[model samples]
Target: MAFTRRGILLGMGAAGGLIAAWALTPRQFAPPLHPGEGEYAFDAWLKIGKDGVVSVAVPDLEMGQGITTLIPQIVAMELGADWRQMAVEPAPVSGAYGNPVLAARWSQLWLPMLSGLADAPDGLLTRRMAENDAFVVTADGTSLAAHELAARAAAAGARAVLAQAAAAKWGVEWEECEAQDGFILHGRKRLPFAALLDAAADYSPPDPPVLRAMAPQERAADMPPGAQLHFVRLDLPSKVDGSHTFASDVRLPDMVHAAIRHGPIGAVRLGTFDAARAKGMPGFIKTVAGPHWLAAVADNWWSAEQALARIAPQFAVGDRADSKAIGAALRKALRSGAADRVATVGDPDTWLKSKFDHVALYTIAPALHAGVETASATARFENGRLELWAASQAPQALRLAAAAALDLAPGDVTFYPVAAGGSFDARLDSDHALEAALIAKDVGRPVQLTWSRWQEHLAGRPRAPSQAVLSARTAPDGSLVALGLRLAMPSSTRELGGRLFDQRSGKDALFLQSSSDRLAGEGLIPPYGIANLKIEHVPVEIGLPTTRMRGNSHAIGAFLVETFIDELAQRARREPLSYRMTMLAGDQRLAACLQRAATLAQWGGGGAGSGQGLACWKMQLDDRIGRIAVVASARRDDRGLRVDTLTAVVDIGRIVNVDIARQQIEGGLLFGMGLASGSSTSYAGGLPTTSRLGMLGLPQLADCPEVLVDFIEAGGEPFDPGELGAVVAPPAIANALFSAGSVRLHHLPLTAEQA
Candidate 1:
């Protein structure tokens, strides 16, 4: 059963003292995965079929992240199964698959009063909360961290039971039999898994199954450029052949298309509309109105969109949001606002009281996700039950929201997860799912709701605008002695937590915004060894609700810290690479990455007119830390600024799938490049001035730079490489522009003029 805060609180009132004890106790849930007729269920993570195919259950979303393949690959390698026999299915929401890592990281959102007690993955409170809520969210790059050990243990157990069955048939010791290549072998006597599945079902595996000597790792030498891979991605062929199913690809009998128009940002309600204008339009069914939006249903998507346009529904806006107001609020807060210390080392207040060597202000405009496919969902309501097919980063949240919108019990809603074309964390919001359910209920049939590109920007929340004043006291050698940062922005992460965990509206959540949010200040602490450093958050509400984007706060924090350091190096007449290396004495991994990246890019000392710049970053979640260094080459031609190449060296410790990791780094660089070039929007009277993707100045194929990526073979715990490249690219490119054109750009996208 799904747990809601209100329901839990009410239960606490009735159960009284027992509720507190019960809340801390661990909860057990039935396995979310069920085997088909010919399959034998081994555990919650995997099942073996009579045909010898091993299907692994993945609890994360597959949004071009290769997670569907990565998890199964882990199971295959650990179970000693052949790669050719591996398959994957999306696991349903259940306590068995709760993501304790993410739940612990986001403890403040769900357990705000006692977040400190539940801030670790293995903590009793964190496990209980995660399992009770089925918090299987697929954000923050925690897929492997949360599920790796569990999946490995499950696979090891399955392998042991299978070996037991094979040994029993051969009258040999189970420990002597080895399972490999989809078969159990003992002195050349072999038996396929299919032959022992029936007997294995009755056997119990060892309490602590023996694991393999090593986890899955691919040497960099084994995957040279253009070399064939041993285990190819299973989803690539279907995607290339156009047979893969995304949320929008789902179709149901007697389904109608819907196009919605949401009011601009602020407190708004749906107003009157000219329904007569679209009454006689071809295939136009009817218009449905909700509190804050309007939708038109028709036989086709194009027709529905046209109907919405023809009707031109209006909305009553109150306290509209404006870009000028947002900027002014940030500036005001930076000048005189209540500051809460996020991170501190030594005594920064005392150091900042004296004169600092350097100070600079950096600004980042609000950016959009600009995903390839807009928000789309297919929902059908009938027989007092709702069936939803959608691609979501938080599927349980989406299901709960849909059920609440329909005033039905949570058990009445069934969700089917599907692939997203590209989310960039956009799928975390469940507004579209709730809208689809409402539309389906109104139409009394299966309804497919798709927001047009225009409507997407109108309704979608953008990344919060930020302004930071960075002050640093440096030594004669350009090494930083102390640093202080005062960042002004909304408590965006807390706002998201309110919406995702508390099911509160955006405006309501913003109303409860606090003056401090550590999640928003992530990555602000430099990896270098600075004696005295302080980072303070000055939260400000700009009458605009912001949500989490791909890189989270690291993208903004890295740009601020790295660029300021580069500027300090230039002012002190020191080489950027050597200057940074001097401060990184404690972090050998980061220093190695910097050295390798500089070598790969052919370091030129970043002399004026050399067209090369350097930046590095580290992302840490719990014990896992991912480090990356980037060297960007850029120059301004007669046309405009052109980035010619980006060379990056990443150290994400152990590599599960080298090819996938490389793809993530390459994609992240380009994604970051896109943000650096454009992807920002300005609000005027609650409407974004930039409406379409073409207007966002996204990098086209011809604009893509030559990306070179390499990984360090440091065998340790694996880290997600998805956000590291993005976090470092903007500052690297900005520093490159400084070298190429002798201009200091303090704003993101390196605009010609500061806003």
Candidate 2:
């Protein structure tokens, strides 16, 4: 029999203080089973047992992104386990799953791109962006910068170092202090890591943990003993048949379901619902309200949904006027002078005067993350306590929000997280689970509230659409002299009050300062080295509540940047490849990737019916380089243009497993393009027009071009570029479409006509 434990569920009212103590009880944990704890259970587990599994905590959701498979491998490799004998479970609610050293390293090559958008003199911020690719050292906010954490890991090698010390004192060489099966061992004499756990926990980690990269001699041996990166090959019985679990399907004796509808955005409406009417209904128990009205204690979800539909709200948009009207207001907001200037390199107006012969005002649009599954959460208030099961990308955020709303201390609420269907970027803004908790708490009953597809489409966070204006001019020699760009729209994340980009300081503030060396504003100039170049962001907040879609909003920004570069190349009568190399005179890796992608795509060998386009990017994060090249191809038919296939060549240093890394790059391509696919998101009212996957204009799989990915590992150095979420794919396809034809597409998602 399998058992799960929950302590301190309730307490007597007479001894009210006892309830408080129970609510605040120290969290229970099941540490990783020592190699001897079991002739059964897992092969390995690590660090925090608060999650009851052998895996690292995940900060983001596992939506379609393959993080579920990738993150566990990192810790398992470090923890010394045969991952094949281990299981990947989402850690409870912790931030330990993050590896800033690697993440910050990848950020260097990218942050510079965002920094170049600053309106500073001579692209001063461009240099900062390049310098702090992973994170800003002195910037404010949550320090969610993964790079800073990397420094801590390296500096705090305290745990590893102590283990080495203990081994050294035991008369064995530190090198012989092999961390085996979570034990510091010397021949037959071994000490379980748990024996030293208490000692290791007290010491402060390194100021900047001195991380020793896994030596080349050690990496091949580091594959968790019997572990091979072939788990993906062992087909799961669930996948091929498309089987999955939705949180609403849970069954408990006397368990019930619910369907909740939230008030329109920004304005909360509390209504005087009729309990008498609902009492007569089959599944109705009672209705209550805190944030929104909820009809709780349902016999069945269907009956509850029916009673909910009958309830009427007594409130309307006051001062905050209309939800529908917000869209229109956003468009007008774009034209308002309140727009902030995010980036300004040179005197763009003066540069345009001397260099640009003409300018093209291209319209770049906004988008959304319409994950196939709608949001859902189930909560039950049994005996003065609350228990919740939810599918949330940010479990910690959701848990905190629920505790705050319920006036319950965070520990009073027990959150049981379910496997998420998908949490594209914006899934972090959790209103779904909180609402469900409120309803269940009100009636003292268990309720599982699910949003309708339409409700999700309108209420869920939609990626804000944007617009950009580009100007390009050529000198008599056909050398590109000036490229001036402006984001006609605003950013979802505001620029920090510092010199470059500022990260929002949340729970992980201090964690981000570690990797500030690789930052942004490096340069907008490609290898061609034209004298004047500029890119600017004109900030315009829609005032409507928005959520992050995935990776960073910068994901879409790369597409715009790459597409514009392609256009500049075409206008100058230069191969995009040659044009990029000239711009990257000082960037050998980027130049090399550009050459590699072109070669793989057979750039110049195209026939009349088929065409190819190329794009390159450099992520100079944490003093490491993660360069990528995108080569896309398509065929022109009498009926319409069709993308036949795409090929991506990436150099994410120290390719842990070529197969897994290849899968990630390929997955990024699909996700990056899905936004504009004809079947998915639609942009209207200066926002994503639709938040329904069925509605977003993404093309079908039949319409999806075949993709082939190849990796050129930068060995000797072990650098992981797991942050490829929003960077390479879109720019690659956009460039390919631009190559297939003369017209340039500045807006995403690339439309068929644009192709």
Candidate 3:
């Protein structure tokens, strides 16, 4: 959910996206506050009960991403509790608990407004796109500010909880006793959390709690030995036992179910449909209709679904609905030279005027998240305050959107993050959450709204299709002289509200003047030392809505950039691995990872039908660097190319939980394997053309290659490991395809015919 580069651009920070603007603004650090309590509340995240149970309110929703467990581990590790004593629940949506890393970058985007230049066109555009500080839990991976904020908050809460317990037990100074192992130790006496809870009920902690180390460390002579750096996931037992309450499981008194049948994105409704047929169905209560929206409310989910199925909703299809036509438009836009320049170095225009050694135009098909779980939200609006429960990565965004729909302040709504069946990027701005809020408000009852798999597929924002024309010019000595990249794609940066531009009000007016080139060209620029480089983006507005996909344009952009670099090596008659090493001369971290991956995969050892390919990249997230390298081995046959093995070496700075990091790498690699091999989307008549699961061509476990993941710490604080494997997988696989055979693929999915 936090992983969309807006797709392909997921983890790649705007290399030079807004460096000048960022430099102009001072960094803002809005730390969260500690909430005092009744009901055992210690802060916005952690709580302790008289029974000695520790509950942590995680801001991010768990979608089988292990975050539910990861968060509990973080809280318990600092709070000195046994695994059995720890519990995790959803935190209220608020900017106070927003992900710092995402907040930092998002704040940069609003520099024009932050600098008080709102009257200017640039400032106005930025202001419109970034109207509210919508707290997002998905950005910065799990290691960045999102998880960092949660961990720090938990540590602080633990210190306070322990301090208060110590003060209450022996009537001693809070600082006199140290806490560990679920007990407050003062001299030779110990007070358990259960016994201290009563006296500490009204205790107020210091502004910031004096926290202890989470992982094992050498402690002062006065304190107990720190805990070990391992955790037994807390949610696993509940998940296995079916005791976990997912969003779909939420049930309130008199709660009714609502099913949605939304029209295709960007389509216009020509007329309204009569609900007579649907109303006749059993359990049918009411029908709601809006522009490009339709919903049926009934006693049960099945009946609501059936009711929707019976009604036929229609929309006037737009011209941009055709996939082939959209692709053609993108290509045309790329050739037009009317675009925005994202990154520029040296004199690329002068170099482009001279001779070029290699040139290629690569295209990638639009892809889908196609997660196992469909989008769902449950809402109950009683009185003025509205409550929403949803599988959202950005709960604050849902609150703001819902509040806007109801014309209320953000404080009027309270959002609870729920367990998602699966949320890739689908929960960024859940339409269902808004729909549920509206339905519940209108019906004057609690309502749970869910989208059918088919409707979800058709209405979901897909990864935008992309085309890049890359040209490289080499000097007489074979050193690269100039590298130029011209990319064309629909705007992925503009949020949901940007779509409805009301010029009269001048609220969304910036949508008309702005180009979403910033998001479209994210990670498209190279981090390597290319003396003369030019990266430009042609913003083509395809009518279809696009959201962040994992690796957001970076996956496809990396595929194009890495494969093209390989092509340049082939043109120069130099080995691909050697060429990459030469290009990455000064970057020791990336170089080390690359060399390690090559050594592990036994690069250049492939012979006959076997081929080994290598690709490496540096992901810049704000000030941090996430370096990764991958080597893929494959065999080509008449049927297609079979990926035999993939060896990856990653340097995400320090390691937090090795198990979770390893899982992220392996899972990310498998996800990339699916995108590189298949799992693409097509469109027609303003809707997804491919509806069935079989047509999508997702890679199963059988399709996953044997992946060997290795971690290489560069000796720094812990960094983000969320999108490392996902970002590196596609390009490495593409490079492997090139090595496997003379047939080079310039498009995605490396179809059977292409293979």
Candidate 4:
């Protein structure tokens, strides 16, 4: 691949010459995993103990996604180890665990102009950059895509050596030995793995270790409800027993608790605070002031919080962000802002120049993550080195950010990864980590900083608000001929990239937001076999900063496209399912999902008063495609909109762990239901009107709709199922509402405009 001159210049501008040179150069680093006294390291992904225990190194953060169990299961299956003897440890930042898949997907953010040249997982530039930066970020559902094959390979090598040891003892060729259930078998003889550990450590694995005929898979039919699980989740027991260590659960000797207060959005500065008011308060320690915020350190978290409240620091805002203003900005941009044509299929300009059969507009409010736990981190700064314990999607970036904030080398910061209570991609930012580091340094000891609920809303970045207008031209048969979509939203993805990769402030990132970002327009291209289609993006700069949410742009794009297609079906007086099926001739997997979902949901043709709606989506990253179809049953009543059931059929190619995949899809559906019904807030005076989690209108247990999910068995690469349900639920619910009551709600948090 050739790098463009413009791309090179942009890379140099964003990352200095030294950084750019390092990114392009191939370098090696020590393995991230270290074995214990009785353990033998097998490459970087796994270690085997003398007692026959297999410890897997997980490079991704575990936020209730079962990745800790999933990765370890992969190793156990490949190495022929028993599930009971499997273990997991968080891998440290190192070149050995680099995630080239994520690096290539985020090339535009890190490499800018050279993104096109390095946009493949196997691209030389992508690998070099990811390895050099130790960029093993846990986002975009790329964990399996990045680590699966490598991890399997390592486990296979380990299996080969173990077999060689057992073969020598049995006086037979290693090739004739079979490993099963943590034991090596030859004819009627069997030897446990523990008996061969010493000898296995000394044997050399084959150049290309032999692999099993098939990858690990669990059929949905075999794992019926209440059936015995083939591979139980490793973290479930600890989590249920309250022993799992989350960020807030970390404790250190002599650790002081700190509560922070951040200024409202826009240009702001710390004004005044009556610290004297907290002087007599019990357990109140000194107050630390930053450029734009204040922190109170005390013996306990509650005391620190009370002290901050008593101090009541004030801030002077320069350009406050308001919900009304944000909405107006999106509208203005959609109406007259300069547009960048991001994607095109054929001659859409000529086809769309004339009259169109149908046109519809959609709007989405700023959505909050509303994670169970707010931003929290424990940091210790001593002996000119900093130690941080936090749950971060981008660990390397967080380490670099803390290092830069403290004016220390990257090596000086030691980052300890911890489980997040719940992230939903909200842990991608390291603002809280940096703040904790600053407070720890200021207090000259270990400090745990926990943002109050109000502070979390004030400091946390929400998903970008958006507006889109979709127009379609139909043929004589009422099939789509040409389609055009104009979306107006901030270059939120680019802004997030700037903050994550370039360590730019939110303000600086907005100022440097690019005119066009392919990531921002992700999923805008319709998956249908449309002949002429054009997608354009109009970048708007709302004063409020926005970060990535669970589904990224797909959440918004799928809502827009799917709903618009539903409307077109209604306009043409056609059946919604068949209409979509007619257009999905090129994607059989997606068509199969739709058929399965409709059958599972007992879809009633989505007719008037049927309370049924259907939506489908396909997420493509390189050659991997995760497809899903949702059939939502909903209705409006005196109380409010009530969703009764959500049935989904997913085709993620192969199933690694059926139980985990089902849990993810179910969790994502509920999460999306929360976003569709609530999880939105209005801003006034630069402060969010909704502060507490309860105010976010999140669905409680009673509000959760019954969910049904079925997986389609297909032969291909496995895809992550984490974000598929999230991308399809909103549109399906909206279409259902239309079918039930002829109520066409265009905005997210469907009640945003209605309320």
List the candidate numbers ranked by TM-score, top first: 1, 4, 3, 2
Any idea what lDDT model 1 has? 0.85
Candidate 4 Cα RMSD after full superposition onto the native fold (Å) = 5.8
Residues 184-274, candidate 4, lDDT per residue (tens digit)? 8899999988788777755767655566888877887787557799899999998899999999999999999999999989899999988
- Tens-place lDDT digits, model 1, residues 1-755: 11111111101112111011111243434546666767776566887888999999999999998999999999999898999999988999877778889998888788888889989888778887777888889999999988887787778777887899899988999999998989989998999988887777567666555778898778876886577987789889889999999989999999999999999888899998988899899999998899999999999999999998999999999888898998999999999999878889998888888798899998899999899888999999999999999999998898888888899999999999999999988889989889999999989999999988888888888888999999988777777888998899888888888888788987788864554677888867788888999998888888888888888888988899999999889899999999999989999999999999999999999999999998999998888889999999987666556789999999998899989999999999998988888889899888999889998878899989999999998877889988888888988998998998657888987666552
Each prediction's TM-score versus the true structure = 0.96, 0.71, 0.84, 0.95
Candidate 4: which pairs clash? 7-113
TM-score of 1: 0.96
Candidate 2 lowest-lDDT run of ten? 15-24
lDDT of 3 by residue, 592-652 (tens): 8989998988888333245777777777664567888899886556645577898998887
List ranges where model 4 is wrong by over 4 Å.
1-28, 752-755
Alpha carbon lDDT of each predicted model: 0.85, 0.50, 0.67, 0.85
Considering lDDT, which of the candidate structures 3 and 4 is the better prediction for this target? Answer: 4
